[model samples]
Target: MLPINIIGYRRIQNRVKSLIKGPLIRKVLVLVSGTVLAQGIQILASPLLTRLYNPTEFGYLSVYISILGMVSVVASLRYDTAITLPKDDKLAANLLVLSLIIAAMMSFLMGAGWYAVGDKLVGYLHAEGLKGYLWLMPLSLFGLGLYQTLSFWALRRKDYKALARTRISQSVGQLAIQTGVGFLQYGQIGLLLGDVFSRMGGGGGLAVQLWKKDLQLLKTVTWKKLAQTAYEYRGFPLIASSSAFINSAGLQIVPLMMVLMYGPEVSGWLLLSQRVIGAPMDLVGQSVGQVYIGEGSPYILEKPRSLMELFYSMAKKLFAWGVIPTAVLAVSAPWLFHFVFGGDWREAGTYVQVLAVTYLLKLVIVPLANTLTMLEKLKWQWFWDIGRFILVVSGLELAYQLRFSALQAVVVYSACLSIGYVSLFVLSAAALKRHVSRSENELSKALMPDPE
Candidate 1:
């Protein structure tokens, strides 16, 4: 048993090390580096934030983030997905300009909507002071949109080091602001201020990098051409962005609904689950998607077979890496939460344990979903998401009608959502294979020797 274990360890170690020798591995490493640091900061700050603020405070913070998160997608007009697909960087710049124009237009529209409906929006969430800081919504949307664009650019340039630095700076800045606010008894102000400071760090850094890169060549872009270019790959990004908004920001609607049905304290508990379960996701998932999409696109174009094989291999790697950590959190969450966050968050452990399944499963499928964007299979991806949306919405509604416990409802709700995510993985991989086969056939035709 000892010899077998040692051999297994050496084999796994060799495979993992070999992964880093490829260019894609470098991007993945850089992206992972950023996520690691950012996650470290979040881990450091989470205890303080939890202790300093109650579930109600977190609930409010979640709502603000949800609103801003949804609006930021609208602000980008889906150009964030286009940065890597196009062969020409100049064309990509035009896509950026187009995203900015849409962002500006949407900002005006959102600001107007807030002015007219601000009270009701806050009232719906059952929170006060939302109207007072309503102005921050639009400003934060701009910041988020610009930051996303810049991040995409860094991805396209394969500037993962810069990207990682920016992410760390932003995380540190946010933690500082929020921690300071906690000390001053500023309540939700801390959360909001932390967000603002982080975006300033991230977006400002991107702006400086963009200017220095001398991408001024983009200035020559024509609006008409850019619009047409945007139209070409528009379906995936546009639908994908909408689905992300719905699924992501849509989580807030659950807490809001729970609060309306059960009360604020229940809502707070649900929010706590989110923070705990969301930790691994924020720490690693986002970074993996960033690098996988950025680096995978070019690989698919140049060496389709190698990319497909790597995709499967990496999926296994991600699963192996995530499983043990997920299991430990699952087993230890209740005790950890009770000790670190007190009775108010004692249930957080259960939440973490329940949701850890989703994260571990996600490690298997999420990277493969990038194939949808790589192959321009937007319509297929959209269908997958819409199906998931229906399942999730339906499951949640049924859970409520049945008067399920908050814990049961969340677990079931997430299980339903995970189904859709897994479905997308299967569909995206199939689509990529079909595309690769067709490309090979075309190449074969072009290269066949002309025999008499």
Candidate 2:
């Protein structure tokens, strides 16, 4: 006979194995494993980075990353998202080609524009530190675009393992370069280069993997097909791109505003707070999101109930996992930051406390927003994005005009964003309900007897 404790342990281990064997759980686990490792590297390196560089340097890097993010999210005009939607591999391949063409053209235009008026723009934003490094923007944008396009292709192929590998490589490459360059005392330039490297990292590996496996399919792509696919997916560029750009601008604009209203050090503090709090939330949320969309896309029309169930199930799991950590951080962030990131960062902890609930809501809602895309409801998403952009900008601008302190401004920003996310969740849920209702009605119509 076995001891009670030993038997219980065995039973628990078996249950764990069973859960891991489920397809959705297995896919999320694969991506989360990579995300965990990647975020872990960055989290561990934060202490050293803070020590090696000052708040002002981080503030400058934040601005650079913000610009990069705002551009890169729309770099492919969001046609990359369409990669996962098509049932036909050839059409998907053509979409991929179209996305690449657009990314290249956009990057060239960005570079040209920067060369023409980069100084004036930098001056306007009070981000003089970015003037020297603005040249790298186009390169970084192209790299990010390539990575995103390929990642979506991987998602479509259900190649979770390759995506996982890419995440790890990106983190490792970023850490090695940033740490080494920091040791050489390159200041903000080191941080900037590391960020640029991270954008391009894993792109080559993914491209090689894709070409090796899908070479024949990709070879079938042609100019005519590319043009046809572009027209077919014009909604992505026309509507989804605008929506995505606005959403990205809302998220990235805060730091720019902070730099203008407070100072680089204040912006740096806020950036670090966001990084520490956001890194884990994003890793888990994005990991689940990738798996959710890949798994849920097929059920949009075929099994609407299954799609709703999946959406509800994911939202519940995210909330359950997020609430406790958010609560703990809300209470202990100030001390934790002081202890972990050093004294200069204690203020960042306060910001974390203010934003913790907002982050939690975001983690739960943002993943499920993919439903809008899967249902071909880009217009709703566009409307929501526009509203969110307006709310965030107006809130921050009001705070600035009122001469509120940095923390007060952050509070206003966080509150406005939280409200926006809650509204988004409600909208997504209603969309799913309508989809389920429509699906059921169509089924009923099909099963009805003829009037004659």
Candidate 3:
């Protein structure tokens, strides 16, 4: 009986495996499994992490990370994002080089700024043990920025497997370090080190993997080419950079503000709740976005109507995945959080519930928002980013000043952000529609014979 049951189970496993053997399905499964495995590691570790590092430690770590996140998007002047756009590898190489150069410059500037104001900044964030750690942000940011530049290059290579593997490696490195450091009683420094080192593992590995294939291309990156590509993609630096920065602020500023307004304890709770929720969100949304941009960007540019179709396809899929799961989380967060992370963390569950709608909207919109870059409406992107940032900051700050509960403030911020995200989606659809219209007009003109 046991042998028969084992044989049956093996047959089912083989059948499932054989079913996903097609190219697109295999790629999606690899990336999805990698992302799921990575997030699973974190989600599984959260209970242990919560036990090992107190709320205050996480609070400090969140502040450090928020600052890094906000600044690092601009590290490459958003040129890393343009790596997939150019058909010419030489042009892409030049863009890649440009990203590294700007990343270094920005990282150095951040370090310089920190050197001058490290103490004031620590005092401002109420960071008791973060003065020395702040110095590490520049290095962390540089690694992260380099990773972004190369990851986009990898995307151009269609190295989705490598990308998926890196996600797993990063999580493993982080969890290993964090667990070990917790035992050494290093406090928040351990969490910070774990994050930085783990990120380095992923980004550094990807950079090294690409170096061999791209070594000759790297050599070909002349000053003339770099200058030419940078000038050609000037819109990225001019328009996309601010837009990306502002978009980052919409997500990251809340943690920094929480620290300022509600102290580390409340901020810690918020950060933990966000982490748990974002784990799944990122696992799905980021994986989808990566695949979408990798496969869809070129098609979208060449066929604008296809871009609109892809947008609809992604919107429908994202809607199905986003709304219902979040509603469940909102309803069950309190009991689930308390059970999983202990009693002290129940407050974060409430915060997660309040944040559910905003996060859902973000989940739906962010995956589709890359279409804006495809259409060169980064100006519209900048506009929407400003709107989101303003909404998040103003709503939260006003609620805080009015003495609303932290949860209440988050609710207000979430409502505002949800509205902003929906608005951006509408704008993105409009942009894609216009792009299709423009392409059609150009095609019609080209097809028509010249009058003699």
Candidate 4:
């Protein structure tokens, strides 16, 4: 009976090992399936959401989400990117624990702060009823931060099957919950509830898995060591993450400024265009981001030269992907918007065209941004981001004050953002090249036989 049990256990272990050792294509199949289904839900939900809620409602949600984005960026602190890249499980655990601790502190602060001062803040935004929703805001953002950070462990383990399953489940859960609530005329509560529930479930599930996998690890690990490790490793990402937060805030800032300068109608149109355009970009970009971070860091550290060329090629491929679609969107966006959404959104198509052109230039350089993180050159990325943020914010204000129309503002913003992306790409590529060349020079000398 003992021998029989041993054989069964060995068979189960071998099956698991086989799945892990499967080809990249097989792994990506699982990943893609989940992503596709999730994107499908998003696609279906968009039209329903558009029908159920007016653009004004969406605009309100957009502003609310933008604020949430900034807060989430702070909560995450780029720990997601950091944890997945390092090889040490203990270090990963430390980072995870630290992320949770910081996230808890941030969540508490944000929740408390919002509760105390939300009316003033909401009034400042010129949006009514926002104060009523303030409690929901911090809960949603904190849950999202937790979900994103916990997702890093799945990538680190190359457990794409699990990752994909959780993502799909979350997306479906969100769609189902939101749709049901919308049917019940719950207003924006539906959207907020969907997000909060999805994140809580996904993050909580991942945390459970991590704990079950290594139950004794926490008992053996010291808090001091965890703190030191997290501090040392997360420094770069912390700064880089702040830059990213600023970049996203830059996008939202334009709409707020537009509302102040123009009117809610123009702001709504612009915000609508941004939502339609940003949805697909985020879906695709985020999916690739996980894959690159999961797989690229070890390759860069071990084979810097090959990884450099590989990264260059990957950038070009991504560029091509963005270029073709952007070109089509640039030419047909206005007409497409009219046909799909009627004349109400015709102006939005123009906004789409403007963003499309900028997105092309951005696509060329953004892939390199991921590589920069993999190479642990987060500071360089931060420098470039800060420079662009300053130029963009300043330029947009000037452009608007000069009475530039929506088109002009879009073009100026795009150009500045493109410059930032290009600058970061140049910096990342140069750093990688220098490292590779120096290593080669040393290796050549070591391998050469000395003459007596």
Best model per lDDT: 2
lDDT of 2 by residue, 355-423 (tens): 999999999999999888888887888889888989988998999999999899999999999999999
Residue 110 alpha-carbon offset, candidate 1, angstroms:
1.5
lDDT of 4 by residue, 1-452 (tens): 57998999999999988876789868887887887777677766666765565555655666677678767777857776687766778777777777777777788899899888888876776755455888887778678778887788777778787788888888888878888988888777677678778888788777787788766765566789876877687665656666778767765676666555554456666766765676667667767766666766776656777778777777878887888899899899999887776566777788788778666766556655777777677677667766776888887888878999867877887787777767777887888888788878888898999988
**So what's the TM-score on candidate 2?**
0.84
Superposed Cα deviation of residue 283, candidate 2 (Å): 3.3
Query: Where in model 2 is the C-alpha error above 4 Å?
Result: 1-12, 22-25, 286-324, 363-381, 425-452
Best by TM-score: 2
Backbone clashes in model 1, listed as residue pairs: none
What C-alpha lDDT does candidate 4 achieve relative to the native structure?
A: 0.74
Error of 1 at 351 (Å): 1.7
The TM-scores, one per candidate, come to 0.76, 0.84, 0.81, 0.76
What range of 10 consecutive residues in model 4 has the weakest lDDT sum?
257-266
Per candidate, the number of residue pairs that clash is 0, 0, 0, 0
TM-score of model 4 vs. true structure:
0.76
Please rank every candidate by lDDT, starting with the best: 2, 3, 1, 4
